[model samples]
Target: MRRFMKLSRKTLGLLIIVMMLLLSGGPGWARTLTVSQPNQQIYQEANFASTPLGAVPQGAKVNLIRQEGEWYKVDYQGTIGWLHRQAVPEAAPAKMDLSKMLFGGPVKETGSDEVALAGKGFTPEVEAGFRQKNPGLAYAQVDKVETFGVDQAQLQKFVSEGGLNP
Candidate 1:
């Protein structure tokens, strides 16, 4: 009886450890989404199970928080809603393209520079300055600029230029 009790306690402790391991450690299956269509309206609310919560033009980006069957739970404008999986790109945390999230619109030249040139027009000096600032930037003009993690000032400038707000 004493041996059996000791064995049972050991088994219980092992089981608990295994359960904790399974719950705490694993592949993070979170999905990050980028709006794949041009002029796609992301509604402020989820009108339907598949209706885009808001319009994310061509390159709007978001992070997937949950999955409801064929739809995705995404963070949009400080709110959550469902978007069709088809509208979002492949789910992977590694390839999250935040160019739009970083700069506002797509990673196009006009889009990226627009924020810096807002209320004004793009000029040679402006372009030169941007080039000087981001020497290694992929393009001379960018519709999007990904700051990788986050920068409030950069985000604010991007938002001021009508970039997607996080």
Candidate 2:
């Protein structure tokens, strides 16, 4: 207490600044980010077709080593991998403020509902009505087909081996 009181104002201010910098993860310090998705897939490379190196459950902390466009290179559970930007929240999204932005914030947010509906824009009411009208639509088969995906990494590997590169 005596030493702190004896310090000049300028010195105290400089000490405070240095402490702040240290706490703020200054240069060469690996910043950390949290996985926000229910499950986030980390790829070996940054692409839709890259091999999935592993997955991180929601709310997992990861050391963010670097970022490239829509992907972040992270250190997760003792492994280095690349995670999609959307799979993590850089920070919680800013709250919507009505009377300050166009259309007064959002009237409706699709959110995870969009994924479950497969982009068909189906509200629960709409889905229920559709089901009532089309009792034999085979929605299960449609959902299965919608989930199919072609691996792009495989195609890249194929091209490299077949001399298809220009």
Candidate 3:
């Protein structure tokens, strides 16, 4: 009975230690990610519109602090900042022998238009297609509007006058 009690206490103590270690989230738990894309900017905030803190060059390693939406809070070169998720490449999919599958024969890899346009928000081909379908629309006026730009001073003045946050 005494041996059983001693064993139970030892097991309980070990379990508690394991639980504490997991909950503490020490340096061993830190996940380091490499910056895969060039011209990656670390923003003061998670948003792209926010002022950029610094630029993290390609191949630089960053420690991931946390993630928010499409942004990741990272510590790069001891400077904590928010980096876009696009800066890191996702894990590659598992390779499989398609030729050995039930379908038989070697499979040739092909890319569809949908796959090409998957992550592309707006493309020239989409614009051309839209123009073709709606010829009556005044695209020239829209293009002219896009060409308009406001100087920094004027933009700041406008924002101040409108009581908007910079």
lDDT on C-alpha atoms for all candidate structures? 0.59, 0.70, 0.76
lDDT of candidate 3 over 4-100, digit per residue (tens): 9999999999898767765765433267888889989999999999999999999999988776656778899889999987888461211234343
Candidate 1 lDDT, 42-117, residue by residue in tens: 4434445344555655677776665544456677667677666556534432222345533676644444442333
lDDT of 1 at 89: 38
Model 2 vs. true fold: TM: 0.40
Question: Worst ten-residue run, lDDT, model 3?
Answer: 91-100
What's the candidate order when arranged by decreasing lDDT? 3, 2, 1
- lDDT per residue as tens, model 2, 37-116: 87588899988699998878899998877666667788998889898877764443222233233355544544654223
Quote each prediction's TM-score.
0.38, 0.40, 0.46
Backbone clashes under 3 angstroms, per model: 19, 0, 0
RMSD of 1: 18.8
Top of the candidates by TM-score: 3
**Deviation from native of the Cα of residue 15 in model 3, angstroms:** 2.9
Once fitted onto the true fold, the runs of candidate 1 whose alpha carbons sit more than 4 angstroms away are 17-26, 41-53, 89-166
